[model samples]
Target: MELEVYTYQFLRRRSRISSSRRRKSRSISPRRLKSRSPTPKRHKRRKSRDSMSLVSESSSASGGPKENKDDSEILKIEEENKKRRQQEAELKLIEEETAKRVEAAMRKKVDESLNAENIKLEIQKRLEEGRKKLLVEVDAQLEREKEAALIES
Candidate 1:
């Protein structure tokens, strides 16, 4: 009987501990849910307001002739840099175009040379054929003359 009472007491204490843990977990989850809902909006508003004030304050403080002069000088430097970059780009394009033109001229020269060589070869072939034809005609005339002499004799 005493052992049964002890077992009952242990089971009751375990149930109580589990119930308390469940309550703690439930309470913590709701707090986290509520805090996460509105934190981002509030934080963003605060940051934007802070940044705007800082910008206004700095602009007001630095609103002077010296600042304007510095700004103009910076602008001039930027414009000069931009012009230099544009000139460099133009020079690069001109160089590329020149290279292309030179390459095309060299190709044209090579083609013309090849065409001239072909023409020379064709002329030589035609000359050789004409020479052969003339030789054949001369031989035929000599044969005719010999035949005529024999007949006359």
Candidate 2:
């Protein structure tokens, strides 16, 4: 009887599902799909220094090159720039090393001062304890002398 009931329930669920109720995934638009797709190669326009000049050098007021930079002058400028960069790098490295050494020395000094302070505190504690013991002994000695004097009287 239980098997019949289980089979009937399974068949009821199968019957409730219909083919017309099926759904399909959404489709992509052409423009968005094109943007996501791979692109083909195309020719590109290039701009040069001469083409970017405001005034034509060939018809200039001085009738000379718009830029006065020669090959040797450009080379000299590049060499000077390289030397400046190297000097700057060396100076920065020296500063960093000096700063590190100074920081380490400061830390060492601080640690040494802290250790000296701790030692001073320990000595002070020991001195206080010694004074307390000495006072106790002196009190006991005075009481013994008073008892002896009374007996002699």
How much does each candidate deviate from the true structure in C-alpha RMSD?
A: 20.3, 29.8
Tens digits of per-residue lDDT, candidate 1, 56-140, equal 5776666755776787788999999999999999999999999999999999998888689787798799999999999999999
lDDT of 1: 0.76
Best by TM-score: 1
State candidate 2's TM-score. 0.34
The lDDT of each candidate is: 0.76, 0.67
Cα deviation at 59, candidate 2, in Å, is: 24
By summed lDDT, the worst window of 10 consecutive residues in model 2 runs over: 38-47
TM-score of each: 0.38, 0.34
- What candidate 2 gets wrong by more than 4 Å, as runs, is 1-69, 117-153
Specify the highest-lDDT model's number. 1
Query: For residues 34-122, could you state the per-residue lDDT of candidate 2 as single tens digits?
Result: 33333232111123444635445543544435344454467799999999999999999999999999999999998888689787798
